[model samples]
Target: MPDNFNFEAAPFDTLSEYERNLLRSALSVGYYVPGETLIEPGSTTLALYIVLKGVVEERGKDDQLFAHYGPDDLFDVRGLFAGQTRHAYRAVEESIVYELNAKMFHELCERNAPFASYFQASLAAKRQLARRDGQNLAEFILTRIAREHLLPAVEVSADLSLGEAARTQLEVGADALLVRLEGGFEGLGIVTRTDLMAAHFQRRLSDDTPVGTLAHQPLAVVELGDFLFDAMILMTRQRIERVVVRQGSQPVGLLHLTQVLSLFSTHSHVLALRIARAETLDELQRAAETLDTLIATLEGNGIRLRFIMQLVSALNEQLLARVFEQSVPAAFRSRCCLVVMGSEGRGEQLLKTDQDNALIHADDISSEDALTWMAHFNEALKGFGYPQCPGGVMASNALWCKSVSEWRHELQTAAQEGRPEQLLRLSILMDAYPVAGNEHWFSSIQAQLSTWSDQGERWLSDMALAALQFDTPLTLFGGLKTSGERLDIKRGGLFPIVHGARILALRKGLMVRGTLARLQVLGKHGVLDQHMADNLAETFELFVQLRLSQQLAGDRSGLRQGLDVSRLSRAERDLLRFSLHVVKKFKQTLGRQFHLDTR
Candidate 1:
């Protein structure tokens, strides 16, 4: 075996070390020049070929190029197992390959079930494995957390005096102490430096008072296996410095926010804290400027796309809510609801895009006042880095910013008319989430929309069919089909999964806002089989992650909505193509489920 061989390559990487060593010993290197044929149609299979360098092209029966394989790519596994070639494999460039003869290949397969499964698995199975493999990548934050040395929890008796608790905290050199509950309470409580300082300044209790009185119950807790990102969310949401770590309900240690911050330290927590503390638009803008830097840092650290989206969504909402509050008077704030539509509302947005927002004013508020406030709110958002929507789907537009009764009437009218464009608009509105003001107003409108959507099959079918607007970009031979230089991955892949999930959720009366959450709900309620739901969820995540990577790299250009496949590694391209195959299957399912052809 070569010293520089990359064992991390797919298919080969999936093999156990023993299997790899056995295969490696039997491998023989072969070379092919550009335009040289390695395998021809109807030719008997001789060996399993793994590309060590350069590219190979696979052509269909008509001699049309269908797929390209590069370094560390494997081919002819299916043919070698079946004893014949289905497609011609020709070198696209000068190439070096390692060959394992038929006898050795068969022996390896017979000895290793997992290695055999890697070559025999279906496209959906490959996608699942790819997703699982991504989770195991070295840069993932969870992988790092698993290797960390956690600190033990510093515990103190609830009956101890404040002075005694302080002395114990100093003695242990801990920032916070857990108070063991007795008598009335059954679980433990927590007391931090903030609590101690507040108590001492308020003069509300003497130092002789029991420390238990200072400790707060119902503490935030995380399991030992929880991802660091999840732990960060818990701390951010609860506004706490530390959380109790448990291993199956038994207290194990304390996870301090400062320790987490030191690990990554890209200033995300500081930015989030600043957003919470901002009192003016300028202050919010200062925090908003850090968003791009924060996003780049998180992506670089290999944080899961879903977690990154959630964090950015949370921060975006905070920025918008603060601007809304500062612009709209307190009196008017309660009378109206500020809602975000589309990706922002779904908590799946990764970067700042055009604003897709609306306002739902109370019935008592006059149209003039509502519009006046909303126009200011829109301009504020634009100034804060959110561009105005091209289609005018924003609060500044009087049509979108309306009273609850007005919205109710508008939806009813749209449903009755059943126009495709109106239905599309309504479909976008279906994803609305309240970011500020009276959420009850938005919920009231959502309930009415849900009732209408549940009763109308025609409407649901129309919405689901929109997902088929773009083809899945895969050829019949399961190879990618690209236009000139680019592929619109969002339209070709992401939209189908998202819209299909949305339609299913509506049919089942599932009110979940995000695509993955809706799929889980549908699966839980038996609307979709577990396997199908899991495949869709994993595929959707891959699409999001790929698109986000392109966006982060500033690769967005005219007519290019996804990554350029020619630039990706052999492994990445393989994963992407397999994911698209899953999308194709999902779209077919949606077509049958909705009777799209007849419609």
Candidate 2:
């Protein structure tokens, strides 16, 4: 075996010393020129092919490109046991592959459970391996604050002169200095270069001027045990560039925003800062446009999709809140609450989709003024690249933007009528997450959803039926069914999970918005078996990730629901099949639970 071969990747990483030796003893290298066929379709897969050099193209029927493999990429493992290759492998360039003997590979699989499981595992197990495969960034994102290069605390006495503090900062090359206060101060104070510059401009920094006087107390601090990501969020939210790192009450070091940015190789903090500092519609719009860039950077860094969604959601909510604060009058703003519905409301939305928002104002407010403000807000979002919701789910719609009493009455009417349109609106509103203003009004409305579910089995059945409306995109023999070489991932995978989880949570009267959170709560309370809940959660994540990858690959106009099957790798195809099966099983569960057929 060549020492150059990467045993650190995936299934190879799980092999034991004995198993590795067994593999090494039987491994043989093969080379092929460009256009040479390595494995012909319908031929027996003699050995598992691991690409050691150059590119190998895996083509299906009609010579259509399925996927290509390069150095360190392996292929045809699924065919090894099946005894024949379903697709043809042609060398796109001069390629060298380390072929492992099929008989020895079978022996290794029999002896090593972990190694074999990678070739034949459920979506959940495969996902776990994928995470392990991405350990560098996966582990990087979960890195603790203490592990990063935190600046050591440069502390000065309360009586230290501004000139002396400046000297100390220069001597240590520190951006800020911590001041130890006298007279029973609760925490240490902080003074930055900005403060020194301000003091210099004011001519207030005499040699006798005390640094403590300029220092601000009650410093923002994070524990050493907290994740570096959490520290970044703290800095973003607090609008601070640096935070004091404390172990218990003792200040140990300072974590600057730059440190966090350096670690992730992303400007997510800078993006957040831009959004935070934006005071005009045009400024916010510019900031909103760069979100795709930030998301791409994060995704490319191998950060978990869930984390990317969460970070994007936070930035989005902030953008909305900023718009709200700027557009609405102070008096009216205090009287109304702004909410986002659908994907945005659930915090699972990655790239920008159509606007799904509503407004709820105090009944005493001027209706005309409220409507005008909401219309402006909607237009502002449109200007910011959030296309108007085709179904009129935005706050600009008078039906959606209503008073507390009016919304309650409207919901009750929907429940009573049990009409399809009304039920759809109810589901959309059910996902409402308050982004700005007095949230109590939104909560008052949200609290009534459980009671509305009690409008009897008829209402519940109607709501649950939507989950089963779309058929799973699978053939009779369990193969993936595609149209125009693209599958409606939203309809086939995402909708069933989202709607199923939504209906299930509603039935149990749980108020959580995100699909994963709803499943978690459901699982914990015995509504769904823990394992099934976990499977559903993972399946939902897989679908969202797939949809997001598709969205990111193309124009960022809106949700890209169609997944091009030819673009998927063999492993991805397997996972998709498994995930779809999980969806089918979940739909069956929902069917039985809600008695969908009878409806």
The candidate that achieves the highest lDDT relative to the unseen native structure: 2
lDDT of each: 0.79, 0.83
Residue pairs clashing in model 2 are none
Per-prediction count of colliding residue pairs? Answer: 0, 0
Worst 10 residues of 2 by lDDT: 129-138
Which residue runs does candidate 1 get wrong by more than 4 Å? 1-45, 50-73, 80-99, 103-140, 143-191, 202-219, 244-254, 413-417, 475-477, 555-560
Candidate 2: stretches off by over 4 Å: 1-103, 106-114, 117-122, 131-138, 147-224, 242-254, 415-417, 450-458
Q: Candidate 1, residues 1-599: lDDT per residue as tens digits?
A: 54455667655666787877887788888899999999998899989888889989999878977677777677887789789989999998999988888888888778866566667875445543444433433243663244254666777888899988878878877678889885432378989877887887876678888988888889788888877777777776655678778777576778888888776566667877898899888888888888988877777666667778877887787778888898789988888899998889898877777889999998999888888888888887788777788899998888788999989987887768778877877888878999999898998998887777644666778788888889888866566677764677888998988888887877776788799899888888887878788878878888787777777787432124656777666666777787888788788888898898786
Give the range of the ten consecutive residues with the poorest summed lDDT in model 1. Answer: 131-140
Whole-model alpha-carbon lDDT for candidate 2: 0.83
Superposed Cα deviation of residue 286, candidate 1 (Å): 2.4
lDDT, candidate 2, 307-390, per-residue tens: 787778888888999999888998777799999998999988888789999998899977788889989999999998888999
